[model samples]
Target: MKFTTATPTGAGPAAQFTGNVWFDVIVAGQEPSRVRVNTVRFAPGAHTFWHRHVLGQTLHVVAGVALVGTRDGVVFEAHPGETVVCPPGEEHWHGATPELFMQHLAIWETDGSDAPETTWLEEVTEEQYSAARTRSA
Candidate 1:
């Protein structure tokens, strides 16, 4: 196998993320392969807006702690080496804790058609974020 060309790290769209967040595309398969992988880094207190995947998504924590929350107010706490999965069409958000930076590998698949693979929803409200922060492990 040959090495793939490198691409620059890119910041998440301001419309979909809060604070400073960046990501590197690790792999984006071509036709006959729907796989996509990204290495995402989140600054302390930074996070993604609520969104859902058409084919589902998986996250493998690489460093620090990751907080993943659902519309129902459930927050799943994941630390380095842990893996988290979100089923197709489940609205959710994920990011680092207020005290630490975090990184995770996001893995997902695009639906094999022209339709978008993700549907981004509203931003995470400050109230919801605070509520999640107060949650006990």
Candidate 2:
């Protein structure tokens, strides 16, 4: 068994996220192992852009409240200890609700040999975000 050194928390890029979001890489497997895990923290009202993983993604909420939205305008509210899964190629976005900060561990893997791990698309429009907030209220 071996212990891996911890890396500093990094800010999520503006191109990929909005508001204030940060993440720490928990594990990024070496060659032959495509697994990736990250502990992400989002400030109230912060969120990721529309994106999808090649092999799919799983999110385990760790604190506060999480809001996950799909392309079809369905937003799921998940609290601490809950897990949400997005199937491969299904565009989605996740982050904190407007009232509280949130944290979640995102786990995913690459599809197969020569496959990209993630595909990032456009940002979530204001209309879509507002709709989600209305639904949550």
Candidate 3:
């Protein structure tokens, strides 16, 4: 029953994100636990670069609207209280819409080894970001 220490909010680096973004670590489990959780805030038009998790990732929208896109140009729209999952190794990107600020809890696990848990790729182009989105029911 140990309480986790508070961690400082961090700016999303330009190398991995576009526009303005910030994140606060919620849970970063130690050995024997691989779970990692963070509350991420994105400014309007902010988004992450193309990336994939080694063991998958989960996102729970907390405010505003979220737009998640895949390699196939399909963007899924998620609103507050909705949850979305990206299966292991499925390349994807997520962020706030152009007109709204957004916040979501980003959850994922670290592979038990030294390898990177997320592989970041190229930034999402404007065409990709502006592509039409399919609303989540």
> Which one is best on lDDT?
3
- Which candidate would rank higher by lDDT, 1 or 3? 3
The list of candidate 1 runs beyond 4 A from truth reads: 133-137
Tell me the lDDT of model 3 at 61: 99
The full ranking of all candidates by TM-score, starting with the best, is 3, 1, 2
Candidate structures ordered by lDDT, highest first: 3, 1, 2
Error of 1 at 6 (Å): 1.3
Alpha-carbon lDDT of model 3:
0.97
Model 3, which residues run further than 4 Å from truth?
none
TM accuracy, model 2: 0.92
lDDT of each: 0.89, 0.88, 0.97
Error of 1 at 40 (Å): 0.2
70-113: candidate 1 lDDT, tens digit per residue: 88887777989889889999999999889999999999999888
> For every model shown, what is its TM-score relative to the native structure?
0.94, 0.92, 0.98
Better of 1 and 2 by lDDT: 1
Candidate 2: segments with Cα more than 4 A from true spot: 112-114, 132-137
Best by TM-score: 3
